[model samples]
Target: MTDDARELADDVQELAEAQRQHWQNTYTTHPGMYGEKPSSPAVHAALVFRAAGAKDVLELGAGHGRDSLYFAREGFTAQATDFRPVGLKQLRRAAQEQGVAARLSTVVHDVRDPLSLPDASVDAAFAHMLLCMALSTKDVQALAAEVRRVLRPGGTLVYTVRHTGDAHYGAGTAHGDDIYEHGGFAVHFFPRHLVDSLADGWTLNQVHAFEEGDLPRRLWGVTQSLPQ
Candidate 1:
């Protein structure tokens, strides 16, 4: 890699570590920051997956496994992964308490790395607000490739991301490319074109924008299908 390229790679890694640490500390400090209820996107995706006869699900950034537990209770076996072990532990406890332990499996996997699961395995893959992390455009493409690799032919993938219109989009300190270091964390806000680029080579099904959270974070909800 050229000197500039190497420096950019190192910066991405540093930012990722900072993000991981921020989330780990947030979960540890406020165990219920996001609460136990299933998110809107997850609920909708679960219904859509069930309608399509999808039985196996792979969830990325499965924070506290809130959505994973929902999938389990809905009769889908879920592989929930997160980079933070603390979040995974909380998920395990939640699963047992919720009586869905047998249906849920937790793993400590970072989204930046290629998925270890075999190709064409999961019937569907789901992620909630994972796309808005401090990931560069190139990293998003890599992550999409991994998601496609693990999904079965014609498998569905549903994800959510904060849009550039979000209240916090330009708040705090800016990092180039619409990313900003905010509240001791990094958020990479997405524009409409980025979403289109990411969904390239796939069958983009739905594109909807909605506002949620106290800052009422603006987000784009997307659903895509891998070609058979």
Candidate 2:
């Protein structure tokens, strides 16, 4: 590659690192940004998983254990993973207080990297808002592939992302490929086509739209499954 190209790539990498730190600080500073209630999408996904007879579940980007604890309370064994140690520490404590410690476990994991689990080990995988976290298109693809790998045949993978219709979609400083920075954080907005591209290998089951927050954050709740 040319020197200019290499330098640009290096700068991008540095930016990504800074983005990671920003997210870390987000959880550290606002420990209850999401509160303890399981998100609506999570509740909906849990119903679907339960109906499908899913018992062993993996939850990625499980902030403060809301959805994970809910899964455990509903009698599913849940393994929750997050990149932030601060959040995981809170998760462990909450599980203990709820007396669901045996049914739930927490691990530090970066969704941008390969998931640290055996292949086909989980009956379902869920991530509420992990897809839009400053991740490039490539990062989302890698995360999808890893989720597919760790899921058992016929296992469901449910996730949510900020859709292009979101109010903040084009309002923030552009980072690239629909990603933007705002208020010390980065977000990657997903157009419907990009969502389809990421679901290439899996059977797309549903893509439902919902809105959250007072600004009404528009999001897509998507569910996909590996061909059994």
Candidate 3:
């Protein structure tokens, strides 16, 4: 990675720590926070699961199990993993309310850590806004390698992240690690190419961009096929 990319990745790690604190606060006060609605990536993953005949799905950064519930409702065995206990507790409750709790497994696993799964165990894995959460290139690479290691040959990997070129970071200004409090902690926006490089050997299947009625959106979705 270039110096700029390395610097950005460091910012992302701090941002992740901040984000964890923010969510911990959010779910502590409101168990149902972020439990009802799925983001664009979650919705997109749901559609893909439905269309692709997915039987087993893994959600890496399942915030509140929204997508996991969606997958379980659609007849797929879904496992939701996140490092936050509070969030995962809410996610478990949310899944119960959605009537998929029995089928959904909530695991308190950090993505940067070694994935505790057998080789080629799952049919698909999806991580929404996960790649950008790493603090450095090594973290990202480890997460990517885990993603690759646990996925079955020909399994699908789908995810989404914020685009750096978007105006959210302000136009004509360089992006830096200076923190700004949003929901209590600082956040980092990632460039597109850096995000794409997270998937070491996966074949890029599709890249799509979408927005919700023009609310200064900057998200891109990527679909890739894991190496067999």
How many pairs of residues collide in each model? 0, 0, 1
Clashing pairs in 3: 13-135
- For each candidate, give its TM-score against the true structure: 0.95, 0.93, 0.81
Better of 1 and 2 by TM-score: 1
Better of 1 and 3 by TM-score: 1
Per-residue CA lDDT of model 3 for 1-228, tens digit only, reads 999877776766656676677767777888766547666687787777666656899998887677777778878899999888987887787777778877899889877679889988988888876665533556666777788888888888898765655455533332354223332434345566665686557788888886543656566788888765
Across 1-228, the per-residue lDDT of candidate 1 in tens digits comes to 899777766777788888898899999987857888899999999988987789999999998888999999999999999998998999999999999999999989988888989989899999998878888777888999999988899899999999888888889987667778888878889989998987888999998898888878889999999888
Which candidate comes out best when scored by lDDT? 1
Can you write out model 2's per-residue Cα lDDT over 1-228, one digit (the tens) per residue? Answer: 999656645654666789767767887889867888888988998898997789998999897879998899889999999888888898899899989999998889888779889999999999987888777777788888888889998999999999888888888687667877777767788999988987787899999998989988899999988788
* lDDT of each candidate versus the true structure: 0.89, 0.85, 0.72
Q: What is the lDDT of candidate 2?
A: 0.85
Q: Give the best candidate by TM-score.
A: 1
Give candidate 1 regions above 4 Å deviation.
Answer: 1-5
